[model samples]
Target: MASFDKKPTFAGLKLRLMNSWMFVAFFIGFFLFWEYSVLWFDIPLYILTPPSLIIENGAADLPRLLDYTLVTGTEVIIGYVLAVVLALPLGLAIAFSTILKRTIYPFIVCIEMVPKIAFAPLFISWLGFGLLPKVIIVFLVCFFPIVLNAILAFNSLSEELTLFSRSTGAGIWRTFFKVRLPAALPQCFVGFKYAAINATVGAAIAEFIGSDEGLGFYIQIVTGNMRPDLAFAGIFFLTLLGLCLFGLVTLAERLLIPWHISVRRN
Candidate 1:
């Protein structure tokens, strides 16, 4: 067999680098305009702080911000892992069994219909003002999307594909792992992306409702103290956290499903 693996040359890499630079340029331009607009309009410092001020103060307060950041990041990561652990097996079981689909799935939908944020206070009351409650809140918020996507992925596989795998002398487990799992991976990743985005929000909500630490609590404190600039700084960091998590999930999808059409197209 002829080997086809090839590393991207510098010329090819140059295009991607230029694209990234364009994004950075646009980002810088946006902030410059924002800073100028705020300064020119004589906006109150407490009302709208310039980007420079946010960066300066944020850097000065980096240590405290980092400490709280780790707290929130921990909650999001732990909750995400737990949701995946619980959802994947449950989803598989539900997909494989009509009993689960008929009996348990309806109740699951009903539970999903209830606002997940409403349970944040209950979790705090039950678990107290600690990491546990925040993690549970994240788990509850992220779990449903994963399970639903899993079910959709499994059902979307054509019947002919399953029959073909069996005809090749593959048992149920072999067929699932080889044929069905690969087919389902794209949709599974779709769930993962959504869950990743929601995970941070869930942790933040829990912190806002009842916690002494984390970025959400930090934002609440700063806003209450009439320091909108510092609150905006917190918001900036929170946005970065969400984007980083979402990027990681996207990278994983690209790696794991490289042969999938969507991955190839991208």
Candidate 2:
């Protein structure tokens, strides 16, 4: 396995900090552009409200947005958890057993090819206009990466190493526990990270189709009321949620597979 110590150099840290500062500066600059457009071009104010105005709306309506955020946040968490639980054992089974993989792989591929959004209404019909649909949607969006990535990782374990272990009289279970499982772990977390990222969008779409609350529902409500600024704020919150999940996955990957090349570089 590859190692990933970034040296934690002062210059590296400084450069990373500068990158973040640049991002913030760019964000502020966008708002400045909007402000200037409003003043200079005599454009429709609503079309290009300055960042301050947008934030004022967020500040004034945070309680409402926060309330909705809690609802959506809950759905994202629940749905992501469900994906992990279902994907883990299932992935292991598919990866470790050729028989199971052959039987299930085709079915999964077929389902994967279908756009899940097309069936959002079906989910609503079957699960009703509640948390169930949102959770199911999240799972549907996320489950594939988990399964596929796990299978790939499981297969990528060095066969020569396994043969050596077997020749040394290590039993199958012992070899798996000592070697294959650890080798596959980096990819397992990778799948989870990607799944969680997509799941946030899934949760929102499901909420849009049926639910009366959550971030998606909030976006729907605001857009209907001609409140694009509030909608953009909701979008901002949604991006934060997804990015936070991805960051957490990255952290977990670092912890679990510090030696894996994918995680070592800062």
Stretches off by above 4 angstroms in model 2 are 1-12, 18-25
Candidate 2 RMSD computed on C-alpha atoms after optimal superposition onto the true structure: 2.6
Question: Which residue pairs does candidate 1 place in steric collision?
Answer: none
lDDT (0-100) at residue 130 of candidate 1? 92
User: Which candidate leads the pack in lDDT?
Assistant: 1
Query: How much does each candidate deviate from the true structure in C-alpha RMSD?
Result: 2.2, 2.6
| Per-residue lDDT of model 1, residues 1-266, tens digit only | 12323468998789888879979899999999999999899998888889889889888889989898899999998999899899987888899899999987888889989989889999999999999999999999899999988888887889898678878998888888888998999999989999999998998899999999999999999989878878987888888888988999888887788777776676
Measured by TM-score, how close is model 1 to the native structure? 0.92
TM-score of model number 2: 0.90
